[model samples]
Target: MPTVWVLGAGQLGAMLKQAAYPLALNVEPVEPDSEHLPNIAADDIVTVEREQWPDTPVTRHLSSQAGFINADIFGRIADRFHQKSMLDDLAISTAPWRVVNTDSTAQEMHAELGAHVLLKRREGGYDGKGQHWLHKDDGGAIPADWLGTGIAEQKIPFDEELSLVGARDKDGNKVFYPLTLNLHVNGILMASISPLSRVAHLQSQAEAMLGKIMDSTGYVGVMAMECFRVGDALMVNELAPRVHNSGHWTQAGACVSQFEMHLRAVSGLPLKAPDVRGQSVMINVIGVERNIGWLKIPATQCYWYGKDVRPGRKLGHINLNHPQKSVVQTALSELHTLLPQNYDQVFAWVKQELERA
Candidate 1:
């Protein structure tokens, strides 16, 4: 059996593990901060999260000794600074941004980019962490701790947040899933609507942009690109070099899930068509107990990560799939009525999307 060593035992890793079973692949997951490393064989496939790439010997060995093994480039374009620079260099439309080094001051950046600016840590920032929003009315002082490497971005007034999850293989073949409309609560993704109809006109453009990025970076495996839809134009937000939260709906909605697609790409298996039969709405279960009762709902699939509940943590997700948009909308409405507080943001977004549909 083909054995793959996954470098992070988080939710993504666990999902990948589940997705690998049908392919008869053994997925060995190792915690990112584990004190000891696993024994590796020459034939073992090494897959890593972007943050853990620097510490994986298997990835290092495979990358350095080119002829020995094929390794996915995890960290190259995962860094926000690198992603921004690359997109800009390629003439891709993204929010106007400026890198802030030790010599750069937030006040100066604000002066240049305007009063309303977003300061983001260049290396590690996700789900609204390591981010500082500065407004002219709130005093333009920069935080002392955020003085290191960062980027100052002009916040765009967007109509909706959008994302596309896709994969490319070694032979240059590519497959893109349907565009998704995402809703964020406190900068964390609250819910998503897949195969978005309001923005159907932009799917071609989004896919072409993703294809360009994959070609330029020689990207293999699944990748997600978050974007801001400002009127008719879509501004690139950032890229995640792995299976992403937004694509979780694919598990039940698509013929080939993102987790399975990622494994296939990295394992050199032929890429499968990302065929979608119906619409899907995914809601994140944040800092909550595992509620298996959701499984009882028709057409609902619950994915509960076996992790302790903590504030702002993504404990699990529920994906609702249906062939009819009205059925999906009705279910979503009933879900909202059942748990009004928990599904506040999600229900609102789902309702809006359904109305637009």
Candidate 2:
């Protein structure tokens, strides 16, 4: 088997490495900034954990390699400006938006988009960083530096935020997991649940939207699409070109994990829709020390990233799943005392979702 090389040795890369072990595949997760580059054979496949990365010697080398997966698709989707444009060109629904430049004015933005606007950096920004909210009441001017470096979008109201994680292979075969209901607190994902019984009606629509993107780009590997549930319709919020945080629950819930699916797709392995089992909840362990108490709960699994903990940093994630909804609920209830008070809202949201008849 050819080696699989992953750029950006973060948690995603680590998980990918773990996934490859069971398949007897060699996977290397390289630090993006490291000056030394890996020896690339003609059959070795290259992929990225991050949508955007700084241009460095190692990155330059891997990007130029013939075996790189989705190398041409990353740059186009990395910039929010081009991403939104592509969505528009495809007739996909997204919030009204425009590129912010030197001559752009707040009045014009409000008039065109709405009284409320969100400015996102065109380049790198994730986990809710590099964003500015402008409201009519605040009465502020768009920062001069943000011009030409950001995309301004109307702050449209939506019933809920959801995400779809799908994978497409070299043969153009595609498979998608069920739509996942997500909860974001201050722009950071706090929790997510999948195989939702209530939103079953929207699954195919979500898949169609994401399938259009992957098919258009000839994208190969796992891709995540974040969306806004507006009434009976869905609007695209952002696109992740690689495995996404929202899909982490697949580690314990699906027949094939997202990490494994990504590896399979990029390596010319057979691809098919994974058999989803029962209910799955993923609680992001942000900025918290790992606690052994989490293991005490039944049907609960923890994946600690082994990274230094800081305020707002993604330390790890906890996955809970069971064939019975009642069992999953009971386990979630058990986690209340084990985790910090910060997770109170997350559990509360989960409770509401479980009770959704």
Number of the top candidate by lDDT?
A: 2
lDDT of 1: 0.81
TM-scores for every predicted model: 0.93, 0.99
**Candidate 2: which stretches are off by over 4 Å?**
none
Tens-digit per-residue lDDT, 1-357, candidate 2: 999999899999999999999888899998989978899999899998998888899989889999999888998999998999999999999999989998888888888888899999998878999999888778888988888889999998899999999999988899999999999998999999998878889988999999999999999999999999998799999999999999999999999999999999999998877999899999999988889999889999999999998999999999999999899999999987888898898999999998892
Q: Local distance difference test, per candidate? A: 0.81, 0.92
lDDT per residue as tens, model 1, 1-357: 658777678888989999999888888777755666566676777675445355455444434432222243455565678879889988999999987777777678777888799999887778888798989777767777766668889978898899999999878899999999999988899999888776889999999999999888887788899999989888899888888999999999999999999989888888988889698999888887676557667778888888898988989898999998887877776666545376676787788887886
Write down the worst ten-residue block by lDDT for model 1: 61-70
